[model samples]
Every structure is written in structure tokens, then in C-alpha cells.
Target: MPKNKVYIFDTTLRDGEQVPGCKLNTKEKIEIALALEELGVDIIEAGFPISSPGDFKSVSEIGAVIKNAVICGLSRAVQKDIEVAAEALKTAKRSRIHTGIGTSDFHIKSKFNSTREDILQRATQCVKWARNFTDDVEFYAEDAGRTDNEYLARVVEAVIAAGATTVNIPDTTGYCLPHQYGEKIAYLINNVPNIDKAVISCHCHNDLGLATANSIAGAMNGARQIECTINGLGERAGNTSLEEVVMVINQHHSLGFYTDIKTQQLNPLSRLVSDTMRMPVQPNKAIVGANAFSHSSGIHQDGFLKDAQTYEIINPEQVGADGSKIVLTARSGRSALAHRFQKLGFQFNRNDIDVLYEQFLKVADRKKEVEDEDLKVLANQYQTATV
Candidate 1:
């Protein structure tokens, strides 16, 4: 088989905005949509048109303005929703109306109080109605992580036959393990007869803190598109982080799958989304974290001083983050101390470095973090003692 290309479908404006208090107005959504295109995202899920007048307007305006990316709108498995979504996306240079219904037994019993036959019938009708507006229709099986594999395969086949160009298997509640999610995609691949007609997409949440892991598993199992949001911002736990998924594929190109994301833009893109959404990414979060490249430990600092690859897998520059900081701390070694002193315009001999390092360690033990002033003061004291 030829190498598969993974399409990045960004849902930051749709599912991401669904997070309470993270709602963005039309201007904010447009700003994010443009950034997504510049970041090389293939499709941007602009908004859910039928949910509110504001949402419908934003989706329409975004469709009108964004020319490079495939602008999309989300809708439920209802005729009205599909009509509204299609209308919103009609002006897009490239458009897709995503329509679907929940297929899990829990959703049928607790949410809709409907039977399996009724659910499948509704799902099939939505796809067909969406196809009436445009050829680019994507059908999602909401909460597919818990839906029976056999029935899910049936829905996949029905939607494809109904003219869906893409099929999304979403772990709506983030309930499945990585291996289980992979098996679900594989099951559809093996059982669905018309699966080849549509692209397989993965939409996993972060309720279990495994959204990125599950996405990789789905891709490894044959998914061609990965739906994500910046900083994993979404309802409840969150969605997969766009930077995490893109960097994973870049780092492991041996898998024979690649994304269109420009890796160097990951950091700036992350900051842009964070500022627009008013969502602060944690310092320890992977990829775009503040401390991802900073080193303070003696052993790690020594290795990093010799070669960054010894302590880091991905280079900070590769993701647009500033290079590693050889922090001066209680655990910092002699080389780190010397490096800091040299930057401060002081060159120390081997003996002077040893003395200054001992003093720096004691000062670091007192302060949580050492400042440049502290280093300079220590250097002055060392010079005075020698005189």
C-alpha cells in the first residue's frame, strides 16, 4: 500500500468553543480560522450553525472569508440542522457539512430514548440530506468508542453508500483505551464493505488524558484524518492537542504517514490560540510547555551542555521554542555555572569555577530560583577575595 497522508481537521472553533467560558465571538473565530490555515490545517470546523444565531453567522462569515482551507459546519442528524449547516458553508471555496447522530446504546437509552433501528435510520437520512447540498459530506458516529463494533460498521457502510466522503469515529466521552480504539477502527476497515469510498477520521477527547495516544493508535490502524484543537481546549477534559499530534507524526515519519503542519509554527500557533480563547496552557504540558526545554539538574544539564539530543528527543528550535536554558540551581553542575558566568562577562579558571559553583549551590538552596544579580554579586565577591 502507498504511504497514507494524514489530514489535520481542526475543531477549535467548533468542539473547542463548546467548552463553557471559552466561547469566542465572530471576530475571534475568524482570527483562529486564519491561523489554522496558516498552520497548514487541511480543514477547519468553523462552527455549529443550528445551535444559535451567533454560531450560524460566524460559520457563514468564516466560510465567506477563508479561501485556502476546507471550511466546515457541524450539524445533528436533523433536516433543519443539515440545511442550516449547508447554507452556512455554501460560500466556502471548499466546504463540508458534518452531520451525524449518537449510535451508542447509552445515548439511545438515556439521551434519545430511541431504538437502534430508529437511530440508524436517522443517521442515514442526515447524510443523504447533507449530500443534497454538497458532495463533501462527513458523517460522525457520536460516542462511537462505546458503540458495538458490528453496529458501528453497519452505520459506516450506510453513510458511505449515502454519499458521505468522510466518516468520523469519535470517542465522545473519551472512554476507550488506545488498543480498544485501534481495534474499533480496524473492525470497520475489515467489516465495512464500502469503507474504501470514504476517509476514516479520528475524533478523541481527553477525559481519560489519552486523546493524543488514542489518535496515534487510530492512525496506526488506518485513520487518514485526525481532528484536534489547540492546547487540547474543549469541554470536560479536552480534545487532542494539535501540536502534540503533528509533532508525533513528524518525529516518527517511519510510520509512512505525514501531516501538512509546519512544525516551526507550532509554538506561535499555540500562543495565538491561547490568546484568542483566553485559555492558559499549563507550563508542564507537552510540546508547547514553558519548561519543556529548560534544564536544571546536574546530570541532565551536563548531557545537554555536551549534546541536547542526549536529554531531549525533539529540539526546542524545531517547535519554535527558545533554546534550552542552563539554569543555575542547587543541582546545576560546574559547566552550567561556567556557562552562566561567561554570559555575564566573567571567565573563571578551573579552581575559581569550583569555588563559585559551591557558593552558587548554597545560594540556590536558599532561593527557589537564582537571579542574574545573584550570580553577579557572587562573581564580585570571588574577585574581591582573590585581590
Candidate 2:
């Protein structure tokens, strides 16, 4: 991979499905896996094979069909988990086994009641076991955001030496700020002796609503892969949003990084995942959100009417969205109302709009938004009064 290339690792089938009530069956998982491939994701984490029989079947079936992108299965540091993950990925043209353990003291002491040395050994052994079945092995440091840098670097080095091709540093609890996460990635890059041997991946959560920001920070600090999900779906708040991160790297040229993602497929794929998982994308969410390209404020609408660049940084059509909307609300100005009417095929002049503006505002005040039907009624009422 090029130094500036960032790999897109989509874990919607595994992590995103972990969200409550977002469970997907084999067919749904395969549907998303194929779509992710078409969207140009570098890797698809099909499922955690050892978690359930259904998940095992989904991973196996997705691995069997997906040809271009690498199919991966999640596993713990346990031997059986690695074995099951390997079996699930047997049919993939490209396959990866992602296995790891907790490296943070909080998890080490509380979750496993083990010391650093024991955990480090377990991490190395798991990677070695994964290597037995496939060369594309990724090791994740669970709760790495909270793990101490020196100790984290040690485990990272040990894993790479043990045959891991990618190392994931996850902000498991969505705890780290951008600067903190960036510094952590930088620390590993500078301190780890064999850091260049494998790719550093960022897996951030959105509890603080900073998953996208933190993931960008990681990429800026030399992490080459971003682990994300469609529509930001995951356990708790969510993981880093795939569309948000992909667009961020694309729009900001100064970042000097790029991914293989097909930007135009973002919205359609977001909707597919949302519909398949029975989860609604928040209207206000970034990128593929319903309100992402909408102009509602009077000031914004006026500026957007004059020049779209003034209010919108991203074109709606760039991400497969319908188009920019001039939503008529009480906050809208006469310019926006005129624009909406013009779009509705009404040739209302400034004087005609001025006459109808009062009634438009009356209806706008009564309703949250004045629709085209309301504008037609107002226009007809104005023409009747004049006649």
C-alpha cells in the first residue's frame, strides 16, 4: 500500500450488528458484504464466527462469495475462537483472522484478572495461531485508548513479530479526545521498533460523538486503516461512521491521505444498511443524513441561492443524495420561498411573491414547514384576491 493510502475496513456485519435490535441473518449479512465490496471497501469483517451458529454461517457464506475485498472474521485470544474464525474464512479468495485481547489495565485487572506479561504472551500466541491458518492476521488491542502507551507499544511490537499483519488500536469506550488519540498513534509510530512491519488501524467509538474526529486524528498520525461501520452502527453509541470518515479524507486534500471507497455509493449504501438492519439513520447525522445538504435558515438559503458554495461544502449529488433542498420553514426568507415556488414551476415575480409572502408566513408559522401544496394554495388565493 502507498504511504498516503488508507485502507477501509468495514465491520458492519460484526460490530454494527452488535447494536441492540440490529441483528442480521445470513442473507442480510451477505447482502451488506457484497454492497461493501461494490462500495470499494478494502476489507469486510463478515462476523464473529464463534459467537453463534448463525454468525458462523454468515461469515462462511460471505467469504465464499466476495471476490475482490478481503473477508475477515473476528475472534478472541482463545484458541478455539481462532480455529473457528479460520474455518469460517476457508472459502474466501482473500481472508483475514482478527484476534486479540484486552491490553488496558482496567480490563487486564478487572476483566481477566491477569498481569501485563501474561496478557502480552497471550496476545503473541493468538497472533501466531491465526498465522497458522492465514497470513493476513490482524490483532486488536481492546480498550487501547485507555491503555498506557509504553505497555501498548510493547504488545504491538510483540504481535507484529508474532506474524500479525495489521494492529487495531480501538477506542473501545469512546474515551479519547482527538489529540490524545493522535498522540497515542504517534507514540507507537515513533517508539515501536517494528512499527513499519504492519498497518496501524483505528477503531473508534462515538460515545462522545467524536469517533470520526478521532479516526481522522489517527490517520493524521500515521494509522493507515480505519475500522468503521455503515451509518455509524455499533454497540452503545456507535463506531466511527464509514461515510463520514471516507468523505473527510476526500474533501480535505491537506490531510494527504486517501481510501478506495467509492464516494458516490455512500448514500445508497448507507440507506441499504439502515433499511436492512432496521435502524434509521439520524436525519441530522453527517454526510448521508437527510439534513446534510438541506438549506433551511433564511440567511443560509439566501446565500445558497446566490451561490451553493456559500452554504454547502459538499454537493448532494457527489454522495448520491437527491439534491440540495431549500426547505421552507418559519425561519426561511422571501428569497427561499421564491426559489421553492420557482422549483415548483410557478413563475412568481418579486411583486407576486411579496403579495403571497404574508400568507406563506402565516402557513409557515402554523406548520413546521410549508410544502409545495401549501405554496400552490397561497398562490391561488393571491390570484383570486387580485382577480
Candidate 3:
């Protein structure tokens, strides 16, 4: 409805901390809030204030100090929770009260033992209550992926009317496929009457290993904000990774959606979060992973040497990572060996390289990885003795 600017809503301190063994104290929360601001997030969902005293203190402190990004505190569809959230965010320059409840049949029956009508009423009342404190209120319909589209549309419309500035559609179970999630978002975009009044957001989990894909699909269909975490660390499998989503949008600006995220700061910020939270980023993750830019395949190494675009969609430098790495392995080619050898100051002609290539191959075949020491020994043997 508005300009195609995709808002990057980072929740690394809130839902991410909810993950078992990923708890963070107040100081750590503030540290991450500052880092998230520096990373250029539009909104930082700091924490659920009413969950605990420590959580409330962290939200309040972060709101007081963080001025660049919108500070948000989460609350359930209850009066006390909204009150706590409001109090916690009072010092924020720009504050949003994130309030909502589950709407799916399973959640309504099994989790809350409430009817659909009751859940809708509770959701609308909480949104209205949140609006009394701040004009910026975000309403989340938990488990929205499986919720009936007609009822979901009704809830979304009611929340918009009740003064919600943003509505979050959470794939709480991470059970929906990309196509199904995209259709769900599209259904809301087309069916909801007041959908344009508020921004549609996505909070996806990685249980099905499709969180990033589902988030991208939501944006393509019409969602404007993506709620994600650093290093893809969150509850269960994790949420969509902020770095992956930011890099994707940055590289493909023609998609008609872009964020304010600083691409070059992604890797450093990811490492900072991972280290502070003790959530090790998997080596093979898409954007900021240790091996995302490393090349080990012979064909891939050759293509990368000729042109980085042949293998990489975005330059590694853009995400604060080094250029393509030529890891010497049994699968490596002569181009890779020659490139690495030149880096070590070896000046070899085509004939000399051809002679050493065979030797290097033999050594590589015997070893799992070719080390610099092995290359040095090989280089020394091929040249005439001067000493």
C-alpha cells in the first residue's frame, strides 16, 4: 500500500532469548539493542516486559538509551501485560507495544480452551489498551498460518480499527510451506478491508527449514516487515536470519522492496551476537556463515577465479566477509593451486606450473587438505638449489 520499503524488525533479544539455554541478562540485552541499532534495524523488539522483573528492567533501560530505532516490548492479550509493556516503553523515543494472542483452532482449544469469538474479543481489547499508551502498537496473531483465513482477516481488520500500526502474521509452528505461507499473506492482502492501514509483518520460525524462504515469499506477496534474529538464533530451529533477508533484498533491489540494514556490518554484528549469546552460527549458513564465501569444489573455484559472479550472487565484501576463499583440497584444480602459490610469492611460468601441478595433485590426493607447508616443500623441490 505504501512505498515498497521492507521494515527490518529484529527480535533477537525477545523471542530469540526465549530459546532454551539462550537467556541474556539486562546488560547483555542493552548491548544487543545498541548493536541492532547500529546494524540499521527499523524496529527492535527488546523483550516481554511483564514476563519477569529482569525483562521489564531490560526493556526500560534499552528504551531509555536507544534513540535511533523503535523500541518495542511484547505482551500477551491481557490488561496487566499491556500495562507493564507501556510502563517499560515509557522512556523510548519511538516505542511500540507488541500485543496479541493465538487465533488457530488448536491454539484456541488446546492452549487457551477459548472459543474463536472470545479470542478475537481479547485480541481487539488488548490492541485498544495498548493504543491508550502509545500510538505505535503492533498486533500479532500467533499461529496465523493455520488459522482460518476468514477469521484471521476479521481479527486483522479489528486490530487495525483498534489503532494497531502494524499487524504481525506469525508462522508460529513453522509448519507451512513457502507457497502456502505466501498464499496466506496474499489472502489477507486481498480480503482484508483495512489491511492497507497497517503494515503486514512476518515472524517465521525455521522448524521446516523454510523460514527465510517463507519470509521472502511474504514480502513478494505484500508483507512489509520481517521479524527475524541475528545468526538465525531463536526458539527451536530458529527464526529467519536478519543477514540472509537483508543480503537478499540488497542484492535484488528490483524486487521492489528494500530495508535500511547496513549490509557491510552483517558479519561483524552476527559474530558479536553469536559470541555474546553463545549461539554458534552454523558454518554453512547462507550469508554470514564462516563458509558461505569459501570455495572447495574444483569447478566452483575455477568459476570464482574467472568471475566472482559465476558462483556468488553478492560479493562477500558487501556482507563484511572476505572474498572467495580458495581452500586447497583433493577436489581443487590447477588454477586454484597456481592462485594460492602466487599468494605465497611463488613465480612460476606456465611450463613450471604444469610440472608442479602433477606433483601438487599427487600430494592432494594423498591428503584430505593441502597445507601451506606441503606447498612450500613442493615449490622448493621443483626449483634449482641455490643455497
Candidate 4:
């Protein structure tokens, strides 16, 4: 059977930059945009053009230089917002206008102080206005995770009719469980008559730490595009991580999905975004974290040394990361100690290691981790005693 193509829509410059103090200048945005193009992102959501003068300039600059990837500018359902986005994306080879309005009752009654019918009309109208500027238009139903599935389908169907090529169902508040998000996508696929006319997209947030899982669930059900960021950087918790979603589909072949992303660039691009945005990726972050491939636990280290596949599903070099590290710590066993010693050019026999293990444990217990210099001291002292 043929694998389905899952379009990677990267929103690092737009949504990911929304994190407080993670803002990027136009030069930084362009740099990341070109890298994202090289990384084979299908669509790069450059910025919200109407948000500010700086944002409009960034989107315009990114659109002018980004040739291969579809450069996209975001906007609200307002006409002025869509117009600004269209003007900003005028120089791109391929451009998309992403415009949408909130659909949930919380947004409808409290946020917009309007009824569902008015919001629905605004949603379709925005797509129509966006269609005037570009053939590629993506309509998002903000907070669709909490929206009624039936009403959400109506909004989706209307947007497609209004010339939306992609329909984004965002877990704006990150409120849905994996099952709920998947079932919601399935509901639209089953209920909407014109659903096949447009691609279903998953734009999930990581408030509950289920953004990646929810995105996968949506894809499994019917979504063909996943909107995500480089390092899961965004408002509140974060957005679905680009590395996580791409690697997940790569590892789980039974899902029968494939993306055009270059796997090796994941780490380099991740670090670039993290540094440029000044947001630190958590050490335990999946795929691109500092400790993602480092083994320190004695059981895990021994298993990893014996066979890398025993503890690591991903080879570090596969993602352009440095080789796996065997960090020596208090919990490390003799096998790990021997391996580290071997790496340091020491030819310790099993008996040599047996004697050194006692002293190594004493040093390890005194510190958080046993450094190479500490190991050398132990090796030298043991050799002196044996001689």
C-alpha cells in the first residue's frame, strides 16, 4: 500500500515566537525561514503581518527570499488583517493566507460577544477575502478542540466552499484528550460532505503536554497536515514540536505516513531556533534534547554499551547530534566504568576494573557524576598498588 503524504506546516517564526522574550528580528526570521526550506517544510507560517510594523516587515522579507517552501502570513478574520497578510506575502513564489476566527462557545459568547451564526459567517467571509489574494488559503477554527464536532464540521464545510484549501482544527487551549481530538477529525471526515475538497490540519498546543500525541491522533484519523514549531516553543506551555511529529511518523511505519523533512537537520535546526529565540529546550525533550541519547543509569548504560538498540530507538548521528554518551555517575555499574575507561584509552582487564570499582564508587558518591579526570586518578592509583 502507498503511504500518505503528511504536509509539514512549520509555524516556528509565527506561533513559536509568541513565547514571552522569544521574539526574533526580521534577519533572524529570514535565516530560520531559509533553513526551514532546506529542511523541507511544506509551508512556513512566517508571521502575523497585521500584528505590527515589525511583523509586516518580517513576513514581507521572508516571503521575498523563501522560494521553495510556501511562505504564509497569518491574520484574523477581519478584512484589514487579511489584506495586510496578502500584501506582505506578495513577493513569494508560493504564498498562503491563514485567516480564522474563534468558534468555541467561550470565544463566541465571551470573547467575541457574538452568536455562533455570526462567527460562522465571519469564518467563511475571511476565506473568501483571502482567496482574492492567493489561491492557497488555510482557514483555522480556533479552539476547535472544545467546539461541538457537528458545528465544527459546518464551519469546515463552509470554509472549503469559500475556497479554503486547508482547514486547521486547532486545540487552541490544549483541552482535548488524544481520543477526543482523533474522534473530532474523524467526525469531520465522516460528516462533512466537502471535506475531501480541503486538507485537514492539526494545530495543537502543549498545555497538557499532549500536543504531539494529539497531532498524531488527528493524523491517524484523517488530518494530512500538522502545524508545529521547531522546539515546541510557544505561548503558555508550547506547540506541537516539529521534531517529535516528524520522527514519530518516521519511526512508526505502520501508520503509513511520510513527510519530506530531512531527518538529519532536526537537531541543527532545533538548536538554531532555540538560540535565536533565546528559549532553552528542556534537557529531557524528545528527539532534540541534550540528554536524549545520553545514558547514565547503570542498567541502561550497560544495555546501551552492549547494543545501542537496547536503550535507544534513534541513533544520535541520525539527527546530526553528537554520538551517544556514557555519563559515569554514582548509579553506574562496573560494565559502564570499564566502557568509559576503554574510551579514555585505558586497557583495564576485568580484574583491574574489579579493584578500581571500589575507589570509583567512593569518588562517584562524592560528586554528581564521575568525570574523566577522576577516572584517571583511580586508574593510576590502582596501577601503582598492583605494581
Model 3 misplaced regions, further than 4 Å: 1-3, 384-387
Q: Which lDDT tens digits does candidate 2 get at residues 1-387?
A: 343999999999999999999999888888889999999999999999999999999999998899899999999999999999999899899999999999999999999999999999999999999999999999999999999999999999999999999999999999999999999999999999999999999999999999999999999999999999999999899999999999999999888888888889999999999999999998999998999999899999999999999989898888999899999999999999988888878888899888788888889899998888998888777778988
lDDT of each: 0.91, 0.94, 0.91, 0.94
Residue-wise lDDT of candidate 4 within 1-387, one digit each (tens)? 999999999999999989999989999999999999999999999999999999999998888888799999999999999999999998889999999999999999999999999999999999999999999999999999999988999999999999999999999999999999999999999999999999999999999999999999999999999999999988899999999999999999999999999999999999999889888889999999999998999999889888999999998888888879888988999999998899889999999888899999899899998999999888888778888
RMSD of 3: 1.8
In candidate 3, position 354 carries an lDDT of 85
Sort the candidates on lDDT, descending order.
Answer: 2, 4, 1, 3
Best by TM-score: 4
Residue pairs in steric clash, candidate 2?
none
- Taking all chains together, each candidate's TM-score versus the true structure is 0.98, 0.98, 0.96, 0.99
**Which regions in candidate 2 have their CA more than 4 angstroms from the true location?**
1-3
Off by over 4 Å in 1: none
Error of 4 at 202 (Å): 0.1
The per-prediction CA RMSD against the true structure, in angstroms, equals 1.2, 1.2, 1.8, 0.7
Candidate 1 lDDT for residue 109:
88
Model 4, residue 2: C-alpha shift (Å):
0.4
